[model samples]
Target: MAITRRHLLQGGAVAAMAPALGLNTNVSAIGTAHAQSAPDGLKWRHGVSTFGDIKYPADFKRYDYVNPDAPKGGVVRMFELGTFDNFNLVVDGLKGSLADGVRLISETLTTRSLDEPSTAYGLLAEAAAYPDDFSYVIYRLRAAARWHDGKPVTSDDVIYSFEVMKKNSPMYSTYYQHIVKAEQVGDREIKFTFDGPGNRELPSIAGELPVLPKHWWEGNDPQGRKRDVTATTLEIPLGSGPYRVKEFVASRSVVLERVPDYWGKDVPVSVGKNNFEQIRYEFFRDDTVGREAFKGDQLDWFTERSGKQWSTAYDFPAVSDKRVIKEKFVNSSSGGMQGYAFNLRRPLFADVRLRRAFNFAYDWETSDRLLSNGEYHRDNSYFDGIAEFMATGLPEGAELKILESLRDKVPAELFTTPYKNPVGGNDDAARNNLREATRLLKEAGFETRDRKLVDAAGQPVSVEFLSQAQGDERSILFYKPYLERLGITVNIRTVDSVQYQNRLRSFDFDIVTTVWGQSLSPGNEQRDFFGSESADRPGSRNIPGIKNPAVDALIERIIFAKDRADLVASCKALDRVLLWNAYVVPQFAGGFQRAARWDRFSRPEPLPKYGVSGFPTLWWWDTAKAAKTGGRS
Candidate 1:
C-alpha cells in the first residue's frame, strides 16, 4: 500500500494499459464514484474531509450561500473544525479563513477582487478614490451601512478596526502596520496616509481590511480576547454582514440565519444571491461516517480525496436511482504545490545537486497514476495558472518583452538560461540530471562510497520525511524508492496533526511533504516559508530554514513590484533561483477537484470561474427546481 513518487511514475507505464484493456471508459471507470442518496431525517447533508476546523462564510462559500425567501426556519448543516491547535494568522498562508465565519457577520472597508472587473473594490466603504498623485487614500463609507444591531457604520468604526487588529492580530495586521493615520474628512469620508508609493497600493490594502465596530468594546482588549476566547458555541456576537448567529450547540452544530434587513441588499454584488434562508454547519469525528451522512442525505455537497472511494463508493443502489452528479474541474489545484521539501539548514541537503538528484530520482507522473489515479499533471515552474512567466519556449521578440519587464527585478543572466521544458516520461533527462547531480555532489565535497553518500567524516547522509498520519501513506510510498537510489536513506514517520506542527516548529525533521498555496500575488510574503529570521519561529511557515542573500533580495523586489510585468519577472527570477538552489523537489500541479452534489439546483446565468466558491456572490439556489429532481426523503 506504501508508495513513493518513483513508484507512481513507474506505475504510470502500467496504468496506461487501462485504455488498451478497455478498463477506463471515462472518469467514472477507474475510480470510485459518488452520488446523493434518498434524504434521511436531515434536509441536506454537506460533508467534507478537512484536517482543520471548518471556518465557513469567511473564505469558503458560506458567504456565497444566500436564502432568498429569508425564511426563519431550516438549518444548513456543514462540516469543519472551530479552531486548529497550530493556528496562525500570518498574512501569507491559511490563517485568514479562521476568522472568516466572524468576518461573514462583520464588514470590511474593502473586499479583494475575486474575478476581473472589480478586483479591489469597497464593501463597507462606498468609494475609494485614488488621484493621479496617489498621495492619500480617500475612503468613503456607505451611509446606509450599519452593524447587525442597527448602529450606523462610520469613519470612527473604520479607524477602530485598524487599531484593534494591529494590537490583537499582528500576524494578520501586516496590511495596516504602515498606515500613518486615518483622519475623518467628512460625514462619510475618511483618509488614510502612508509613507510614499504605499498609498498607491491603498486600494489593494484597504479592500482587504475588515472594519471593526468602535463602540462595541470601548475598553475590551484585543490580545486578551484572542488568548482567552474559546467558545464551543455561539456567544452573543454582532456582525454587519448578511447573517447573524442564531444558535450554537458544542460538538453538535451551529446555525446562522440571514438578517431580513441586511443593508445594501440591492447592491450589484448582492443581487440574485443568498439563496439559502438559513445556513447550518455540523461536525463529524470520522470521514467514513461523514461520507455516509452525505449518502443518507444529511448533507448537500461533498468533496472526496480518495480515488478509491470515488471509483467504488457510488455504486450503492440508492445512489444509482437518485441521479446524483459527479464532476471534475481541471487546472483547479488552487495554486497548491505538493512536494518533498528539505530543511536547507541541515548540512546533508545543502548541496543543490542532492536536491536535483532527488528530483530526478522521484517521478511525478508515476506518483499520480498510482496514488492520485492519474488525476494530476507534473509541474516544472512554480508559476501556475495565469502567471505570464510560465511560458517554456519563447521567440526572440516575446523573450525580449518578458526580459525587459523582468530585468529590474530578476537577474539579467536569466534571459539566457533555458526554461525547464515540460518532461514527457522516464527519459534521458533523468539520467543526465542524475549524472549532473553526481558531479555536483563531488564538487560540493561529497562522494558515494560503499553504496552510501557520506561526508568527509564518513557519516552517512540520511533524511527523515515527516508527514501527517491521516492521508500521507501514498506520499510516503512514492518518495521512499527514489531516495534509495541516490544513496540516501529515507525515513518516513506519520504523526498526528498537532504533533506534526510541533516538530515542524522546532525544525526537527529533515524533509516534509507539505502543501504550499500559490496566491494571486506571489511575493515576499513567502518569508514565512523560506526566510532566515522565521526559521525558529513557531508560526512561521519557512520550514526549510533556507537563508540566502540572493533569495531574500529577490523576495523584496517581488513584493514591492509596482506592476504585473515586474511581478511576473520577479517571480520567474525567484523561481529560477529557488530551482537552482534546489530548496524544493517540484511535484504535481493542476490536479482535479472531484465533488458530488445533488442535481436538484441549477445555475442561473453567468457561471463563475473554477476557483470561486459557489455562493451568494455567484449564483442562487432554487428550492423549487431542486424539488423536481424526484428525490424521496
Candidate 2:
C-alpha cells in the first residue's frame, strides 16, 4: 500500500501509521511444483518472520491483544490535518494528497501482529512457502477472500497490484526492488522471485505487497471514462478489507463503513478489530483547528503531537468531568531519528563539520524546557528507544568488528570517542556550545566577516528551514537566534503541506524537519533512509540525501543479518556512522503516544507492547459509556 498522508501529517514517521495491505497475482510458473507441495528445499508455513520465531501457531485463535467479543457499532470521527484530493493509492506521495485511513480498505497477503516485533500472519494468504536461501516466496491465496463487489480475490489482482505499485510509487518501488518477478504456479498461488538470496527480510516484505482490484482499475467509471491505475481519480476503488468507502467529499472528509458481510471478518486476525461501523476523517488546515474541533465534539479522537499542548491544553470541562480521557501509551518501537535533516543535495550543507556545528548550536535543553514543558528527551541516536540496536558508549564486541571493517570509509572519531550531543540549558552552557559551533564552522572554511559567516568565495552562508507545521515554525524560530549568533543567516519558510511535500520530494530545501521511523527489526527500509541509490530518488525517504558507501554496506549487513545478534550489531554500526557524520541536528522524542479521545470506547487490557495504543483497532464501543458521554454509536 502507498505511504499515507496521515503519516506525513504526523511529522513523517511511517512507523506509527497503519500497515500497508498486500496482494498477489498470477503469472507463468517457474517450475512444475504444485501449490500443495513445497518446492524441493522450501518449507510451507502459515506465517513468516524476520528471524525464525513464530509466536502464534497455525491453529491458534485470534491475536491475544484484542477483545474477541467486543461490541462494534460506533462512529469514529477523527481529525485529519491537511486536505486530501486523492484516494488512488498507486499515485500517493507522488501525485496528490492521499485520503487519510485509505489503507483500511485494502488487505495484504499477510497481516503483521501488533504484539510481535517483526512477524506476520496470513490474512489473504492461507499459507506461504520459501526456500532456505529465500530467493523467492510463494503465497497461497485464501479462496474465502472476496472483494466488496462479491468477486473473489485472485492471483491476477495481486500481480497487477505488485507491478503497478512498484512502477508508480517510489517508496513501494524501493521497498520491492529485490523482487525481480512474480509468477503464478497454482490456481490460487503466486510466487515472488527476488534478485538474489540470503536476505531474510524479503519474504516478510513481499507479504506486505498491497493488493489492488485489477477489474476496477482496468474498467470504466460511471461516465464511461477508462480508469487508470497510474493516475489520480475520485472514483471509489473496490476493496477486500473489512471496511469500504461509503461516502467522501474531495479535500474535506471521507467516511468508510464496515463491510456488513465482510468475507474476512471471521478470520483470526480480524476477530477483535475493525470495530467501528463508520470511520470518518474530517480534514483541517492544521492541528490547532483540529484540536478546537475535538473540543467542540466534531472529532471523536485527537492525538496530541505538541508536548506543551499535551501538558496544558486539555483542561476543558469534558476532561475535567471524565467525559474525555487523556492518557499516554508506552511506545515500545524504536524512536527513529526525527530531526532537522540537512539536504546534502544542497552544496551549502555538504560539509560534515557544518552539520556538526548546527547540532552544537541547537539548545535542545532550553527548547524542551520552554517549548515542550520538559516533556521530551533529546534524540541521541538514530534508533533511540531501542537499547539493543542503539550505538552507545564505545563500539565493542560484534559492533566494533563491523565498524572496524569500514574504518577506511567511516569517521575515525567514531572508534575513539562516544558520540554525544552538545548540552545546553543555562546561559554559560549555551555560550560554550555556541563557541564550539563557531570553532567548527571556522574549521570548515567559513569566516566571520561583517558579523556574517562567509564561505571561501566570500558569499554569505545562509540556510532556509522549510516547514509545513506551525509547531515546526515555532521550533525553528527558537533555534534561529542560535544560528544567527554563529554569523549564519537563518530563514524559516513555513509553507502548506502540499508545498512542503513538493519541496521535500524535489530536494529543493536546505533543511527540513522530518523523521525516519524504524521497526524493531530494521531491514530494506534502511536503504530508503540512508542508501546511496535512494539519495537521489525524488520520492524516497532519504531526505538527508545520504550517499555514503559505508552506510550502504551497513544497510546490507542489517538486511542479510544471519541472526538477531548480527542484526543488532549491524544496526549499531550504522547508527554510529550516521551520528558521527551528523546528517541531522537531533530533535526531541515524546517517548510515548500522547492521545486524548472521547471516553465512550474501551480497549483490551494490557494492550500489545508494540501497538502503541491500537486506537479504534483494538478498541470497541462501550454503550454505557457512550450514553453517559453522549457519544455516537
Candidate 3:
C-alpha cells in the first residue's frame, strides 16, 4: 500500500464504477440509494457502487469509520522521498515532478469510502444520474460547493477541468479515453458522455473527476501573466478543498494550512477528516535519511518500507521509552505485483524464454532472507493476497471457460500449469534453478562465450537495473551475482528520483523494480496498466510495454463484467495469463503496513477495513499526549 507517483498524481477521482445491470434498478428498500427520476429517463442516486449496494444512505451522519467528536488542531510533519517541481496536476505525467499532497487541495465529484470495496459517496456532486446503458453520467454540484475565492463551483468549471486534464495529461488521457465528451446539461450539472454503452464503471469514473475553478485558470497570475494549465508552475494555485499551500521552499519543503472557513467542512464526507491544522511535508533524498530525521523529531510520522529496518533500526531511546510508537496495521487489500519489471521494448527481452530465464536466475529465497530478514511473502500472482482474483491450482470453472476462449491468443502452458516462483533456499536448489536458467537461455539464442553471455548477433547480454532507492540496490546487488553466474553482465545504476522518473517516462532502462498497486475493485485503470494502447504512450503506466492481445481482451472483460462472479473469474484468467508470460520477475509482498510515529495522536478503535493506517485522516492530535511526547501541538 505504498503510494507511488502514479497513485498520487491520479488522485482519488478514479473510483470503481458500478456494473451495467445495477444501473436502472431501484434500491429504495436498501435505505440509502436515494433513486430519483431524471429528465433523460436516467436514475439519479446519492452514490455509486461496482457490484454491491452502497453502504451509507442519503441521510447518514458521517462515515462509520470516523469519530465525529475527534478534535482536530495540531501540526503533522510528514516526509516525501524526492523533490517536486510541479503543482499543476493537469500536466503531471507530461511535464514535471508533481508535488506531494497537492491532491488535498482539490475535491473529486465523489469521494470513495474507506470501508467499502468499491463505493463512492458524493463529495463535490450531491447526486449523480446515469442511464441503464451507462453511456453517460450527469453530476449535480452541491449548492454549498465553492472555490477558495468564494465563487460557486459551476458546471462550466467541471467541463473545463475534464477537458484540460484529458488534453494535457497522458495518464488522464488514457484513463478517461472511453469518455468521448463533456458538456453542461444544467446550470449546476455536467454530463460526461462515453463512446458507447455497457461500461458499468463509467459513471463512477466520471464522478471521480476533480473539478477545478475555470475562471482562475483563465485569468492572469499575480504577476499579470496568463496561466497555462499545460505547464508546471510554483505559484500556489487556487483550491477549494480543506487545505491550501501555506508556505514552501521549492522542492525542499511545503506547508499546507487547513482552511478554517473551508466550504466543505460541514459536508458529511468531510466531517471527520483533514484533522491537521498545518500539514508539512519535508523532502529527503531517500528513506534512509528520512528515518534518521524522524528519530531526531524532524518529522512526526514515517511509514517504514524496509523489513530489515523495521526489525532492527528502531532501537533508539525514544522508541524504548515509549515516546515513539512502532506498530503494524493490517492491510486487507490486493497485494498487487511488485517486481523487477522487464522492459519488453528492449530487443533483449522480446523473447519469452529469455524473460523466463531471468526469473529462474532470481534467487528470491536467499534475497528475502538477507534483505528482508524473512519477513516477506513471495508474490506469485498479479493479484496476490486477493484470493478471489488470484489464479491458483490451475484454472477451473468460469475462469477456465474464460481462458479457453482465448486459447489461440494466450500461451498453451497457462491451461496445463499453475504459476509459481522458482524456489532457491539451499545450495542444491540454487544450482538446480541456475541450470534451468542456463538451459532456457540457450533455447532463447544465447550462449556463453569467454565467461560472458552473447546473443546470436555476437552482442553481450548486459542489463542495467535502474533504481532510485538504496534499499532497491541492496536486493539488486544480491541478485546480480546469480545472473552473473549465467554469464550475464548485470549493472546496477542508481540515480536521483528526478532522473529515475525521467528514464521511466522515456522507457530508458533494461529492467526496473516497480509496483502496480491493485484495489479490491479493478476496472478501466487496468487498461493503463497492461493494455496494448498504453504500451507506446510516453507517460502511461504500462511500464513493461505489454502488448498482448489476450491481456487487452481480459481487461475489457473485467471492465464490462455483469456481476461479482464474472469480475472475479475474469481477473483470475488475466492473472494466469500474465504470470505464464513472465512479464516481471516476481517479488515479495507485505501483508501489513509498517509505521512509526511520535506518540502524540489518537484514533478511533477498529480502523476502517481497507485504510491500513488512517493517519492524518482519521487520527487527531492529543494535547496531553503531545505534552508527554514533546510533539507539536
Model 3 residue 632 CA deviation in Å: 2.5
lDDT of 2 by residue, 1-633 (tens): 112223443433234322211211111111222335665546568867664445687777799888999887988898777777778888876776678778889889988777766567889998888876778999989999999999999999999999999999878888899998998888998999999988777877888888999998999999998888888777788899989999999878999999999999888888989998999989877788889999999898998888898988898999999999999987774457789999998888888999999999999999999989999999998887776778999999999999899999999999999999999998999999999998988998999999999998899999898877776678899999999998999998877766777787788899888777776667887888789999898878888899999999999898888877787799899999999999999998767878899888889999887688888788887889999998765
lDDT digits (tens) for residues 129-247 of candidate 1: 44334355666677889888788988898776666555555233343544667778778877777656522344345545567666754534444453222212123455688777676
Clashing pairs in 3: 17-201
- Least accurate 10 contiguous residues by lDDT in model 1: 11-20
Winning model by TM-score: 3
* C-alpha lDDT score of every prediction, in listed order: 0.52, 0.82, 0.82
Q: What are the C-alpha RMSDs, in order, of all predicted structures?
A: 12.9, 4.5, 3.1
TM-score winner, 1 or 2: 2
Model 2 residue runs over 4 Å out of place are 1-36, 39-42
Candidate 1, residue 516: lDDT: 51
Better of 1 and 3 by lDDT: 3
Ordered from best to worst TM-score, the candidate numbers read 3, 2, 1
Tens digits of per-residue lDDT for model 3 on 1-633?
Answer: 112224221211222211223332232112234556664966668877665666787888799889888886999999777788888888876667778878889888988777766677889998888777778888889999989989998888999999998887877787798998999888788889999988887887787777888999999999999998888898899989999998989879989999989999878888988888989989886788999999999999998888899999999999999999999987774457788899999899999999999999888888888888998999988877676778898889999999999999999988887788899988999999999999999998999999999999989989999987775688888899999999999999987676777888899999988677776668888888899999988878888999999999999999888767888899999999999999999988877778899999989788887676877778988999999997766
